[model samples]
Target: MAAASIMPPHTNPPPPATARDPTATVSDPQRHRDAPTPSLRALFLRAVDPSRPSSWSTAVADLLSSGDPVAALAAFAAALRANPAALRPALPPALRAAAAATSLSAGRQLHLLALRSGLFPSDAYSASALLHMYYHCSRPLDARRAFDEIPAPNPVIVTAMASGCVRNNLVYTALSIFRSMVASDSAGVVDEAAALVALSASARVPDRGITGGIHALVSKIGLDGHTGLANTMLDAYAKGGGHDLGAARKLFDMMERDVVSWNTMIALYAQNGLSTEALGLYSKMLIVGGGVRCNAVTLSAVLLACAHAGAIQAGKRIHNQVVRMGLEDNVYVGTSVVDMYSKCGKVEMAWKAFQKIKGKNILSWSAMIAGYGMHGYGQEALHVFTDMRKSGLKPNYITFISVLAACSHAGLLNEGRYWYNTMKTEFGIEPGVEHYGCMVDLLGHAGCLDEAYDLIKEMKAKPDAALWGALLSACRIYKNVELAKISAERLFELDATNSGYYVLLSNIYAEAGRWKDVERTRVLVKTRGIEKPPGYSSVELKGKIHLFYVGDKSHPQYKEIYAYLEKLLERIQEAGYVPNTGSVLHDLDVEERESMLRIHSEKLAVAFALMNSVQGSVIHVIKNLRVCTDCHAAIKIITKLTGREIIVRDIKRFHHFKDGLCSCGDYW
Candidate 1:
């Protein structure tokens, strides 16, 4: 009764915790067991002295550190409730560390205790800790509110808020906060640099200016020398597009090098399409290793480099290393494996790796979908997407993009429209330029040229080269020179440097027998010096890729290759194949024209691939340009006479020829 009388009332109690010494850890059980029941004021006064508040807090932390988070969390909550103002700071951090180490239940207990203690509103420090508490517990909204409620927020609170928004995909919100902080020149605050650094890591592509401003602020405030803040700046620069790697390199060079510094540079190079540079940096990282472990992120970066370079051997070695290092099942690593294999044209290997993943994340799903789509396995891609949905995984914009591309390739017009609408109606994903391009390509490939043109014209967003290019391509196939000219003019207006558009228009004029227009187009090409990309054809034999061009005689077996091609031509012609040489736009005599068509890259590659394989084996050819009419006719005859499937993936679409018919049904 006397002790109760000595305690202060709830109305004017002591300040809530978190302002006390970070080192005042409550670390035992005996004191709590034997102590008198002190008043809140007494507890506050005693805690404010900076001595260890209670041994119980430390004991709980020890329990948490030892992986007995249940007990540690329970003990921490009990101690915190005893005198919240005196115990919250010590308990929340310990509880959060405990939660990260072992149990979310421990985190939950600490959070609930904070809420129940009625100290969260009164103490800014406590609120900040609570914000971090919720963040660590994966309750980002709660963390956001806690951060917002901080009376006069610091950089720590601002950083936490930005991180929370980004984790939830509120990229714009994070960007605004970062902009505000920069505008106010909050660089004087020590944590402001850290906040700017953190926000930069999640900033969108357009926010590169903001990110650079933050970096400038960091430099102006003289905090660029801080290693942690510098590393954060490095990550931000990499994530924020349009960053100058020169700046990143300069900062990295001036800083005392750490593993993180090296890793960030390597990742930046890999992410920004400089795969060769990434590999070079990785070599440097290897020579300069200083206890910097090769983390999953680093490994994933190098793996992507392998994908871009098509370095299958290097990727395989990395895969083995990943397994040996016991990181094979890491989701990020698994996703990278799928991507590498897919890009290397090992679709089956990608599928096998995908199946082995215990829990497939959205990235993994997107990678697989992309693999199937790229391999021209449209039906398989659709099936994978269906499976993804059945597994309760929501498809992101990338996923839809892949699926829509598959539909475009397979000419699944209805399915394409369904998904195009679904992304907007069901998923609330606004269609971007890429998405609109896919839709236009879908309708265009389906021979709905009018509808495709209308879609482009009615697009809420402005059309890009891809959209106009699709319509122009459709015109070429449909022999609609009027539409072709209109689309070509629009395309040139939008992108004056696209030589392909001019070349396509010239070809269309040739097809329409407009000699003057063809000459005019050639003159324009000459004046602009727009060099058309040389057409290339590739054939795979015994897993080796053999390449050829229209007049390529580089093969070691050039004589034999020509002899074999001539014999094949005689046989196919004998089988009633008349060379359709009209697609040859070059002015030449009839015999010379026929000769050129015979030696066209696709014909050369196909003839070689056919001769190298078994009699009935299917031949798969990839061509850099659209298959010419003569080549398509020759392939149809070859497939019919030899009874072999000849799958040709040209620039426009896949041509799957079996028996005398193609998937495009002679339309394209």
Candidate 2:
């Protein structure tokens, strides 16, 4: 298309040539030879076109500054027709307009004009602008070709080229270009922008060796002392290149930090599962980052940490801050608050937060549905899912997993089967491994063992350890030793290192009185050095976390906690709570197994929470493993005796115990 058709000429006369940033033009080497400071009309009137008036270049700049890029292109064509020399000062703005509009067609025409006018090789500003234009338009190949056409690139041109490659996810290529920038002669010396690009590349590929090299170069060039480059490297570390939390913490401790710096470190700690440390860093930001008030990003990251750690008190405080800052409507922070409350075992609070989100994105809807599902409210989750679809947001694969899981817990087998069968046909989502696992769990929970096994056999994707492990757990509950053995074989083959599977199979064998099989499995586990993660329960009370292991006495208040637990057991037994010693799978006599059942980790955590917190307050306990059947029953009775609501989150799902019953209907 012609330039006039692309951007028709405007009837209004354009303003002066010096309308945009003075630097937004191709640098002219000889233009300074004119007047020391030219008048407004002659500002860009270089001697290259003494015959042409400066107004030709003036029109292009005016249209560009006024945000009329289409009109700018038309004026650019007129300027070129008047004098080709005008391109030296007028080309950069036209390229800027192209980049801003993300128009590759207009940019390509300008690229041709720049090449034909002999400005590409000499003008650094024009070359950089062209590179940025191609980058913004998402044409990486054109950017690389434009970059290659330059003979001797300056630092600006090299930085621009590296940045474009990094933006396009050609990280290794960006690294190569950065290396050349460092190795080339004086004109291509590494600058702050080039260093940041190289650091970003190192992070994407997650090559610690490359990051180390760049880190050394940054230090040698004294860029490490600057906040901009330092924060970039911190971000690289956070993304898991060498993931050296120690080095990252050290760098974080020494650097002159900004809000971005604090946010990166917090995200790094949280991502590495050091959520406690992440929360600590956020606290430090409040105290040490004197001028750096918390922003939506900071609150979002810290709220996620709170969710993972069950730091509800800290989460509530952050929510209050979000309200104070009038960021209650921020999609990110609002969604984070919902997730925090949901995972921390406060679904009612999550619903409140979910309702307050003004622009509820897909993530917000998914979080709310998952929250309802975890609380054993299958009907509520389905209703919210329907509302999500009505709100014009299509459910993704993750949403289906939550739906099926809710069905599994609430015994909605028909609904679960309908969603599983139609996920591909209705939502166009082929069931992935996670979806398959959720379906297996759902079918197995409903005692449809034959059908669950058949589904596993018919799966298009390979069955993972989680899928087989689900079947093994179901077999233990349903007393199907035959299928359990087959599931065990597949589970061990896929993930031999998972100690949980070995324990699950052993428990199945033991519960069946197949002592020989149990002994054999235990011997195999011992020989392979497989150790199950010790079960521990944690309760977040008043911003401080309390941990309890089986018969734990490590706390300073162990005396009071143990004493309280004994009184609770007596009271619960008087109220018809029987200690279900059947869960103790070890080869012990009935008395020893009964004694062992009295002090399970979750019971101790509940006792501690009961003693420390105010009367009638709800207690939340987070477990690192599945809650045993004995503790599940006892907690339901404890909720009744203490007149409190106890929420327990195990590895598989959340169990809400209130009024002498569990939300799972004693099924899970």
Candidate 3:
């Protein structure tokens, strides 16, 4: 292709050159004779005379204020063609900065102009600036070509190229270039050292080998512990995952920590699930020293700490501070609020906070969807997901995870399958193990156990413990002992140390009346030293969660709780209720078994919630396990007898019992 065709010509000419004389001047014979040779800058200064007839040199300077950089570059190119001497000073920098600020089309036009004029390789400064423009415009290959053609790349040029890679998330390429530069003969120089040092410091790339190499080089140059480099080093170590808090703390102790250092340490602790240490460090920062003012990042970090601790009181206080600080609408701060409320089991508050976000990005949608899914509001979760799509926010992997989970809980089997297919068909997202697990759970919980098992067999990647466990839970609900055994075997084969699968298998055998098989399973469980998971129930009262386990009688009002249960039983029996004695796993006499079924944790929590609340109040109960068969029966009776709606979120599904029936059709 002809080089001229690359840069389209300008349709409009520039203003008269004399108008730009203030910014640049032209060299005359007398001036060149006096100076012998004029510098590129002096040539522009000498050219700036309004009395001098307009030349191409002054026209190039006028392009800076053109508002449209593409047109400016074209006019400047036309001017350069008219007077080759105009590129002496202002033209190169002006063209470069303008290209950097404009679109790729404009940047390419500048490159075309340089190529057509044969000035691209002749001037190193202009060439470097052109390279920087290409880097800014996200043409990394073009940047590499520009750097390679520069003959001798300077530190600034090399750093710009490496940084472009970092910005584009090609940290692998950044490390490669840094490695090549450090192995060079003059690695100890400030220019080369700064490039590698900054790369190591930024934490964009998390390879200890590469960072350690850079650290050694820094020490070779006697440049260790410089605050900027140290901060970068600390971030690299913290984010790299191999480095421990001990090393990070040591680095922090040795260096003079500004806000960046403190923030790095606090964030590192939070990222690693070390919330206690992170809060401790934050307290130390406040009480031990007083100079540091917490910025938005610092406050968000502490807010995350509150979320993890489930410290609603502290989180609310921090939220108040966040509002007072006027960051309630900030996306990061808002995300923290959504996460805190969701983890605190107040998803409505999370949603309320999410709706107030002035700018909703992917994180905002993901947080809200996840919150709704956590609260078992599957319909609300699906609604928010649809709203996200209507608002033009493409669902990412995490968003899909939340949506799939909602479908699983709500038994939207066909919708779940459609979205699962859409991940790869429309969005080009290959299903990960977690996504596959969600699909299995969705289908398994929907009474499509055969299809769910087939899905596990059909997965591109091997199914993991989570997928098998989901199938096992479904088997337990549907009383499918055969598939339960298959799922149990698969789970044990993959992860033998897990005791939960053993319990699930044993429960399935018990539910099926296979006593011989149950005893065999018990022997296997004994051999593995597996313990069954304890049952727990949570009731929200006066903004506090009151949890009770099986056989729990430690409550201050246990006597009243039991008494309420007795009266409630009397009323339910009067309303034609019968005890579901079959829930007792052991083979015992019906009367003896019926007596034991009344003391389940969920029943205790239900009785307590009824005693504590007034009539007509909706009782919300969250259980750690699937609602027992006997408890499920009793809850249906209690709902009709007491005229109350009870929402029970069990491990496998949601049970909405109203007027002697469950919303799940007693299928789960």
TM-score of each: 0.60, 0.81, 0.64
Candidate 3 regions exceeding 4 Å error are 1-12, 15-109, 126-145, 164-188, 191-226, 288-290, 389-397, 412-434, 456-465, 481-668
lDDT of 3 by residue, 1-668 (tens): 11132244333343354343354333333333223122233333434442333444444444334333433344455445444445544356545545545467656766766777676766766776677677667777887887777767776666666676776666777766666666676754355445544545346654555555565667777777576777777767666546646767887887777787777888888777566677777778877545976678877787787666454655677788788889888998898899887765567788888987878889889888877875567789889999999999899988998888777766778888998999889999878888888888888877899999998898898889989999999998889989998898889889876666665677788878897887787677667765446677767665355677775677788878888887888788787777754442433222223444337788888998888877887787768777877789889999987788887767655577899998777655
Name the regions of candidate 2 deviating beyond 4 angstroms: 1-147, 168-170, 185-188, 205-213, 570-599
**Local accuracy of candidate 1 as per-residue lDDT tens digits, 14-114:** 24564334433334332242232222222333343333445445554555454444444444444444544436456555545543543455455555555
Q: How many pairs of residues collide in each model?
A: 7, 0, 8
Please report, in order, the local distance difference test score of every candidate based on alpha carbons. 0.69, 0.79, 0.69
Q: For residues 304-337, what per-residue lDDT tens digits would candidate 2 score against the true structure?
A: 9888877788889888999999888888899999
Top candidate on lDDT is 2
Question: How far does residue 68 in candidate 2 sit from its true spot (Å)?
Answer: 11
Candidate 1, which ten residues in sequence have the lowest lDDT sum? 1-10
Once fitted onto the true fold, the runs of candidate 1 whose alpha carbons sit more than 4 angstroms away are 1-243, 246-256, 287-291, 421-430, 515-668
Model 1 pairs whose backbones collide: 26-54, 26-57, 26-58, 27-55, 27-58, 28-55, 28-56
